[model samples]
Target: MTQFASLLLLKTVLLSGLALWLSVVVVNNLTAFRGGVFSVGSMMAMQLFDQAPAISTPLLSRRVTSEGWHRLVYGFVVIVEIVVALLLVYAALASLGAFLGYADATAAIGYANLALAGFVAMGLIMLVGGAWFAYYIRQEGAQITHFALIGLGLAAGLVINIPTP
Candidate 1:
């Protein structure tokens, strides 16, 4: 196969991997809906801050105690995940089509860009939400995971956009 074809295959694989990752996340969230809601509620309620009362007391005002809001946020997150996953799957298919000469590389690249943008946007939303709830203060693992996902999305974008000289 030509180098261009190789690049397209690589792009397709990357997009498919991202789609699979998000799809699994969606399934997990749906299968454990209550658990997901509980996680969101804990973050919004700033429950972790209770362990550090000295620093947390003043920031307690940021807590969102409403169960309704927790469910809403979790629902929104799941919806976004589903949409992004679909986009990624579509983009991957477009890349594969381009490789097979059924579609142009430009179209595949455009779809990939859109999918990556959505992926990064979702990560940013979660990161910002976590920050608002002071998740970094105690939930170090969650913050790291969000940052890692954002990095992966960006890295994939770079990999797929390399010049095809």
Candidate 2:
């Protein structure tokens, strides 16, 4: 294969890797959601907000705290995660299309824009949910490692989204 073909192969592979990674994360979240783990996680994260905003402050609801808000935010995060997973799936398909000659930079970049946005959100979600939640401080928190791993995973997606020429 020529240089351009090699670049195309690399892009395709990276996108595939990103898609697979995001799929795994989404599945894990879904499992956690089913297990009612997100509820606990959200509460813990919110607790940090009130007592530890110096440690973990949410964007809009930092001041108006309540259990109602915690549940509300948890629901919102679940929806956002599902949307992010959808975006990743779309980007992977577009990447495959690019490989197969059915798509181009515009198409791939379009899907990638959405996926990249989701990746950013995923990184922040883990940061606030883990780092800000004092997961790193906790001796028993399971999410400390998950937070770091997911943040790295999202960063990898950004690297994969870089345009190749």
What value does the lDDT take at residue 51 in candidate 1?
Answer: 70
What lDDT tens digits, residue by residue, belong to model 1 across residues 1-165? 899889888888889999998999999999999999999999999887767454635677889999999999999999999999999999999999998999988889999999999999999999999988888888989999999989998999998798665
TM of each candidate vs. truth:
0.95, 0.64
Evaluated at residue 72, the lDDT of candidate 1 is: 98
Deviation from native of the Cα of residue 125 in model 1, angstroms:
0.1
- Worst lDDT run of 10 residues, candidate 1, spans 50-59
Clashing pairs in 2: none
Give stretches of model 2 more than 4 Å off.
32-71, 139-158, 161-163
Clashing pairs in 1: none
- The residue-by-residue lDDT of candidate 2 on 14-82, one tens digit each, is 667766866786677667764445455444544444443344434424233455655665666667667
Candidate 1 to native Cα RMSD, angstroms: 1.3
